[model samples]
Target: MAGTEGIDITRRNKKPRLLTDAERDQLDEFVDSIHYSSRYNDDHYEYRHVQLPKAMLKKIPKEYFDGGRGTLKLLWEDEWRGLGITQSLGWEHYEVHEPEPHILLFK
Candidate 1:
C-alpha cells in the first residue's frame, strides 16, 4: 500500500469524538456558574479548549508529544473545563469539549 510492501497505508490516525449534548450542557453550566458572576465579570478572560478522552486520541505511551509541547498544551489543563487551570491562575477560563467525530482536535 506504500513504498514499503507491509505498510498499511489504509490505516488512519485516531480522531476525537464529538461532545455529547449532555456533556456540552454540563460544560456550559459550569462555565457560567464558575467563570462568570451572575451580574458580570470584567476581569474574566475566557478561553475554550477541547481535550478529548485519551481513548479518542492516538496513544504515544510515555510521550508528552511526538515532538515538543505547543501553546495549546501549555493552555490545556486536561481537567474539567479548565477548573484545574483556575486553581493556579486567575482571570482565565476554558472549556475542553470533545470535537466532532473523526475530527482529531489534538495531535
Candidate 2:
C-alpha cells in the first residue's frame, strides 16, 4: 500500500464536546458579565446591541466559536434569552456584530 503524506484530517467533521464543569462555570460567568442595553436606532426604534466577549474562546471549541455570525448566534441564543433579550416578534432583536477577531458585538 502507498502512504499518503501531508494529508492531515485532524478535527475534520468533528463535533463540539460537552463542556466540563469548569468550562460551564466559565461560560456562565462570561454570560453574566454581559450587560443588557437598549438604545434607540436612527429610526428612533429601541434596539439592543449585546456584545459577546472573546473570553469564551478560552473554553469553547474554536470550530464553533469562530464559526461566523449565525453559528455564534445559535450557540448563545438560549443564554441570551435567559438574560432578557427579546426576540424580533415582540421587539427589535440584536444583530451580530463582528467588529474584530477577538470580539463579538450584537447590535
Candidate 3:
C-alpha cells in the first residue's frame, strides 16, 4: 500500500481540536466588545498576553515610582525591581516609574 501524502492525508482526517458553537460565539462577543479611548490615543480596551524576561527588568524609567517604600523604593533607587517581590499589573516584570505609559510586547 502506498503511504498517504499531502492533500490525501488532510482529506482523510479531521482536525483533532475544534471549538464548540458556544465557544465560537463567546469569542465573537469578546472581539466585538473591544472599545477605544481618546485619553491617550491608545485603545485601552484591547486584550493582550505577554511574558517578560528577568534581564529586561532594568529598563523601567524613574517616574512611575509612586515614591513609596518596600519594592517601590528599590525600583526608584536602582531602577530595577526584585523578582518574586510583589504583584503589580502595570509593572508586571519590572516596576514602571515613568509618567508616560509604555507597553512592551514580544512575539
| Tens digit of per-residue lDDT, candidate 2, span 1-107 | 11123222231224334455665665666675555555545443434555545565454544444343423432333444543334443342233455543333332
Ranking by TM-score: 2, 1, 3
Q: What ranking emerges by lDDT with the best candidate at the front?
A: 2, 1, 3
Give me the runs in candidate 2 sitting further than 4 Å from their true place.
Answer: 1-23, 61-71, 74-76, 82-94, 101-107
**Which numbered prediction scores highest in lDDT against the true structure?**
2
Task: Please list the C-alpha lDDT of all candidates, in the order they appear.
Answer: 0.28, 0.42, 0.26
**Clash count of each predicted structure:** 1, 0, 3
- Of candidates 3 and 1, the better by TM-score: 1
Per-model TM-score, in order, reads: 0.21, 0.42, 0.19
Q: Can you write out model 1's per-residue Cα lDDT over 4-32, one digit (the tens) per residue?
A: 23222222113322345554544443333
Model 3's alpha-carbon lDDT is 0.26
Better of 1 and 2 by TM-score: 2
What's the lDDT for candidate 1? 0.28
Better of 1 and 3 by lDDT: 1
